[model samples]
Target: MLRFENVSKVYDDGFQAVKSISFEIQQGEFLVLIGPSGSGKTTTMKMINRMEPHTSGTIYIDGKDNNTYNASELRRSIGYVIQQIGLFPHYTIEKNIAIVPQLKGWNPKEIKARVDELLELVGLNPEVFANRYPKELSGGQQQRIGIARALASNPDIILMDEPFSALDPITRDQLQGELITLHKKLNKTIVFVTHDMDEALKMGDRIAIMKDGKLLQLDTPEKLLHEPAHGFVEEFIGKHRIIQNPELMPVIDIMSETVVTSLPQRSPEKALALIRQRKITNLIVVDEENKLLGIVSAYDVIKQLNDIQTIDEVLLPAEPFLFDSATAKDAIIMMDESPYGMIPVVDERKKVVGLVTRGSLLSAMSSQWTDSEVAE
Candidate 1:
């Protein structure tokens, strides 16, 4: 629930780092700010915590002006994790994590419990690591401590400024996955800054692309991948990326929108005739509102044609279905689990919008290899 309205930042020396960018982040949304060097992504993130104050325009946090709160109080209320793993080397792990809650006047017992809970939350054993200093832990472990410290006060928002950029590649990847899992578990509003596009795509719910201190586009990863709003944005996200990585392609993009459907109340005779006419094995059955009911197979219809009154009697559960937001990778993984080798793609309201069939999945996957061959 953060909103930035025409926000700009100018330094004393006269250079502007952020140029009147306007955007909003919804509650529990993981928004990633990304761009090349001098693109103002990092500056935009820092402005959220007032690490670097803007020269003009307004930044509202939960509908209140960020400037309305005391600077220290505001900063303390927002969790911040940086690339350097800024843990006090002398402080024990427990003490490092207790800093924020202590400042907020939490009692020692509550602080100790919070410290232990957070250590476990970040995948560390408090019993083993609580008394240890930062020097005793590995880089990844230290980063976890940094995260634990940031969450010590249980802030509603967390600002991660390339927090995993300094780690080894393997560790960076692991931490990225862990952060994604953590975000889903905690459901906190996260504003992450990264220069890596792949990282941005993999981790961000919505990505904000910036250039020359201006906000170019702020959209979902799927939208950003398929529909680059600007020439620079398209160039920044390589045109070949989607072709090379089918996982990046949203299912809605490649799915067949012309799904064969029938009413669940239809008699088995009519359902069988419809399937035969369409030369299909299964038919997606929906209610009056077009909400997905289930699928009825032709074999089942014919076998039970006389026994069943309505097609709903033989309708199969719509398991392993994909939502419109799912990517090709999701459909691919769930394909084997689908009874009829097809998955219905539904909207947020569970209304069937499209269908991803085995053939469509193969075609989408084949395109990647074809593109690679052409490139070669």
Candidate 2:
């Protein structure tokens, strides 16, 4: 819902903070701007709310020029969170969260209800935290309060400037997970800025890598890892480190494309024959288009062999499948968490493309470690 066109910002000292950069952010998408300290990622974000005006070009929010809106109005319509957890020390948590609604002229009753609702939404008990001051809360709790404050008015977009950077690693990880859950629930377009690659990869739908005030590469995390745009992109991604770590490798890299399948309408006898021929215990059931239907194990088919005529009659629901875009680490964790022996891997359309088994993971990990040791 937001678009930037040839946007640039030059300081009065003749320094260009942001070179002409253009990108679009889709509605409900999490886009991350990542770069080093002098890369101007923050400057680009500030320009959106007019906190820092661009020296040239235009920014549009929801199809209207951002400049056309009054500065105060534009900012209030967009939620903002910063690294410092900017909560007013003098104000109680309830008062801190109610700032925006109060300024919007909400009545006392509405404001009070909103404050309580927001506190609960952010995982804080209204009764316990409502009267507490900012200092009374831990850093992570304070950060949640800051987020609640930002969402006080239910803005359609949120801008987060390294919001979790100051917390300890464990707290930062928790907040990141919470933010992802919140984004799914709220469906708000979020533009997050961070210098940490891991955070960008975990949280962003698309990552924008910047350097020297210029956009370098913008792509999904999968593409960014497998098909970097240039030498700079490759080096910046820490290719050697990724190659050495199987966890960083995408599932597609090691998944077996030779998946055995049975049509949902196939007879149980036929499906069992296919499974035995393939020397496998289970067969993935699919439709005419090869889209995954579910799975049918030999044990299930045998149990119902005399009673059931078709595989459909004995088909069991498929275990949770992984997308091709997911990392090997994701697959490993998912497999460990479940009782399934194998997980089907699918493309964006949920069509079965490959399969991942415990054997494949062990082989990939072993090969990667060997390669790393050889390189060393």
Candidate 3:
């Protein structure tokens, strides 16, 4: 864990890169520092590893003053990654990753194992890439190598400064997802810096917005979007404002629990009778445990009524469904993209729990809008 107390950084020419900023990073938390250029976000992060020394105030790492430890020793204990990667050109990928471990006086066998383990952890094949030079890999591959290097020592905290900014969109998205999974698996406290709001929202457990060498607001992504503290915060969160609203609305809030369903082993006559009784077009097909199998429609049953004896023969492909914990936005998107009129909501074991239809989405949105208008 890391904590900053009234931290400020000033240059010799009288320029203050950072104001007195205070924050505590809990263990296993992904904290994103975001702002426009020159907002002191990077400066604040650099101060943690002593990359940029604080001119005033104190920084503590694991309850000890950062200044008390030798700078090299402190930095070696903390993993640092930058946008440029900074991998040594002449070093093989394995050597690049083993720099810290080697410095820590690890034996050759231990260092080799650690290098292989880190390479695999970042989705790289150690056998193929262990001897490859940095130039032999793609930009995304190089960035992954940089991450492997950061994790080589298994540090408790990792500092990332725009590590994925240079890659293409698809690659960047992949790396972002990998980083999230990696964070959960490693459980390391990460301080990430980015100027992109979408990245901050998707990756950060909490976002800290800064501007002009001062901290503006720090809150969870939902709160930051719905309840911005200032006009600058609102402007900074521009365009994706809708994400703040619908993400909070759970699928259960608007789903219809009276879904008509048929058993997979049922005959076509039985399924057709239920469909006609319910006056619905389609029925979700489930097994004995109510776990989703597929879907059956009245038209299919009628077509196969004479040809086949069971509903399984007339079953139609099921559309992609949603989990009970999914948000309204997720349901809306799934409905918009799919041809099915309704999406079955499932539990952890894929048992049908409820159904979310287009009508339900519209009703939910209409209610939300009306409430907002009345509040205004």
Candidate 4:
């Protein structure tokens, strides 16, 4: 829970780094600040932990003025991670992570437990990495350690300033995914700063676009993609960029309304016959009220035709289904885990409304590219 009220930062020589930006971050929200160099994105983040104090306006953390707390104490209470992971070369990974908790006067046993837990949380083996020095690890590992150290004290808020920009593309992508998982698992309010629009869209619950020391736009990734408020915002996030973000497309637009469904009580022979007649790969098994029960694949129905009395006996678990309100991105992500390359879309009452198959999903996404090309 952080709020900035027309916040500005001016240096002693009168260089205005931030120009009265006002925004509020909800609890457990992943808010990203993005802009080009000298755009005050970093300065805005620093002002949160009082690393660079704001020159004008008020900053409140947890409903209280940030200035009410001691600067050193405030810094210690919040987690901070940077692109250049500044881990001490001589200190062991365990010591580096334990610094924050140790300074907070946590007991040795608690600090050790916390360090080991954080190491595993960042996907590193504590037994192997805890005693190793920072230099002993690779760049990605060091960045992970930096993250672990930042999270050492289990702070409620974390500030990440281009934390993954320095890693290789593959590693950067991997770390981005890992950090996303961590954000959901930890549910900590994260203020991430990055210059990359792709990374911002992938990471942020809401993105704040800044330019020339002013806040230009602040909105959800979907809203920003569809309706950029400013000309500069549109230029910054190009048409191609908007097309690339699958979250912009509603799942309903790509899903098929003609879903082949069957009652769970249907005989295996009849269900197989229906599957063949309809040329459908899977049958959506439902109740008398049309609520989804499970899915029966044609392969399974044929295999178990003589072995089972009813189609329900060979039913596969209906998982990874999306609500009608979901997005194309949700379908895209869940498609891999879906059996038979199909995802059932359901309504508020758990009734099957539509289905998203691989074919339909691909077709919709391909059309986005075509549209982008035509617009260009």
Candidate 5:
């Protein structure tokens, strides 16, 4: 765990990067610091390792003041990864990763083991990459090695400063996926710094929004997207954030139960009647036991206007299903794959519970829109 109390920094040139800020980071929490350049995100993270001492206020690492430990000793316990992917050109990949272990006086065999463990952990094959120097590897490979190096000592804390910013879009995507997988497995208390809001939302367990050298808000990704604290935060969070947050609108929140019915037969007349009654383009159908059967669409019914039978005549099978608590974001993904106007929600028993529509999700988010008259 880490804590910062009333921390600030003012340079000799009269530039201030951070103002008095206080916050606590829980153990194993992936906290992201996000804001525009010069927002003091980098300065705040550096203060944790004592690389840049705070001009005022005290920082505690696991309850003890950070300043209490020797600078080098304190750094050894904190792993850092940066945009440049800094690596010693003279050292082999294995030697680069083993630097921290060697500094701690680990035996050669132990350090080698640590290097091997980290290489495989970061998705690199030690047998192939161990002997390669920094120049011998591609940019992404070098960055992966840097990560392995940082973890060599098994640090409880890891700081990442735009670690994937330098890579191509495809590589960046690949690495972000890898980092998510790695973080879940390692469970280190991570402090990630990024200027990109989308990246922050995807990676951060909670985001700390900063502006003008001060903390604006700290909340879960859902809260930040749904409710911006002030005009400053609204400006930083971007214009379409509300529309983008389908995760906050769960399917259970706005489902209509009265409109759903069970039927195995098909009838255009009945489907049209149901549409007119419910004021919807479709209706849900299920088995006698309440398990999901399929959906009856007005479009399909209208296509067969002369047909008359059970609703199954126009009913289209619902592709894949989700539970009630999977989050609105998950729904958006399913919808995108098939462009569903609405999707049925099923319970643990595979029985239809309700439904969620695109309009419902957007309207739920739109309710929190900020007044345009407010200042940023």
Candidate 6:
């Protein structure tokens, strides 16, 4: 829906903040701009609606040069959200949200309804918040109101500049998930800016990594992680490369380094709860010495619930089944046959090594496929 054609930005002082960069953003694609502090991502984004004019070349919104359209007309059709939110302190949330719709000459009834709908979409109770002023709301709530105001115009594209960067980590993650869900519903073309890698991976349809005044690499998260374009790209990704290890077989190789939660020998109820809580169907059986003895399955718990009040009845017989050095392909097949979502990785001694899951294995396989295509 948008295109940048060999665009460059040079300041009066002769600093080139954005070089001759070019890329296409498909309709409804969540394109993320990721890089360090001095990178040109913000500059590139501002040029879209001529917030900052390009020094040379063109920015085409739907195949027409941005310069050809009047600034007011162009901006009215686009949604914008920033890290600071920039809401009017004196205006009520409803009034703030109603700004664009009213400017667009929407009917009074329509504007009111839209305010309610957008507030609800952002998890705010319209009845309570519609009359509240910006100062009365929390920072996150104000940010949401800013987004509601952006969507009020029903724009075809949205420009978000570090919208969630000011929030706490947990709140940031929660909002990221909320944005991902909203994108599926709204399907508006989005240009997002962030330095957080996981956010780029989770939300970006394609990530465009930038350096000082230049575009570095534009690729899917899987491709970016598995097949970095250069040493710079590799260094940019950093320890996140550990997440894309295709050769690491079995779950044990990549399980969280923190101590595993253990199931008490006599707690059948705890075992059953753990199965659902961990989203895993199997529980590792261990003794007082912190040694792996056996494993328990949910089926085993349900089957002998009447005869046993404890996990001893469901505990593995003998050494139990061992999953040794299986490739991702082998693991997928084994998981398909067993009731467990994944089997524990073990060595020749049948000792616990690591863990893998059906979902994680599938993610690995996808990275392998995309990386192969990237190689070719």
lDDT of 1 by residue, 96-131 (tens): 999999999999999999999999998788899999
Q: Give the TM-scores of the predictions, in the order they appear.
A: 0.69, 0.69, 0.69, 0.70, 0.69, 0.70
lDDT scores for all predictions? 0.85, 0.84, 0.84, 0.86, 0.78, 0.76
Candidate 3 CA-lDDT value:
0.84
lDDT of 4 by residue, 1-376 (tens): 8999999999999999999989899999999999889999999999999999899999999999998999999999999999998999989999999999999999999999999899989878899999999889988889999999999988999999999998865457557767877888899999999998778876789999999899999998767877789988877877443344568778887788999999988998898778778766778989998889889876567657789998888888789799999998999899767645679999999999999875346444433545656776
TM-score of 3: 0.69
For this target, which candidate reaches the highest lDDT against the unseen true structure? 4
Q: How many residue pairs clash in all the candidates, one count each? A: 0, 0, 0, 0, 11, 4
lDDT of 5 by residue, 1-376 (tens): 9999999988889788899999999999999999998889999998999888888888999999998999999999899999998899998998889888888899998988888888889877889999989999888789898788878899999999889898864346556756776887889999999998778876788999998889999998778867888788776765444544455666665454554565766466866776666566566788888888877665556646775466676667787556877676777677534333567888888888777664354444434445662343
- Pairs in clash, predicted candidate 4: none
Q: After superposition, how far is residue 330 of candidate 4 from its true place, in Å?
A: 6.2
The digit string of per-residue lDDT tens for model 2 on 1-376 reads 9999999999999999999999999999999999888999999999999999999999999899999999998898889999998899999999999988888889999999999998998888899999999999999899999999999999999999999999865457557767887898899999999988778877889999999889999998767876678677776766433333656788888788999987888888888778767777678898988888898876668668999879898787787789899988888788644334578999888899999874345444333434765587
Instruction: List candidate 2 stretches off by more than 4 Å.
Output: 240-376
* Total backbone clashes of candidate 4, pairs 3 or more residues apart or in separate chains: 0
What is the RMSD, in Å, between candidate 6 and the native fold over all Cα? 9.9
- Pairs of residues clashing in candidate 1: none
Candidate 3 C-alpha lDDT tens digits along 1-376: 7888999999999999999999899999999999999999999999999989999999999899999989998899999999999999999998999999999999999999999898889878899999999999999899999999999889999999999998865467557767887898889999999998778876889999999999999998767877789889977875223332567889887788999988888988888778767767678999899999888766567657899978888777777798898988898788745444568999999999998765345434433334554565
Winner by lDDT between candidate 6 and candidate 1: 1
Error of 5 at 303 (Å): 48
User: Lowest-lDDT window of 10 residues in candidate 6?
Assistant: 252-261
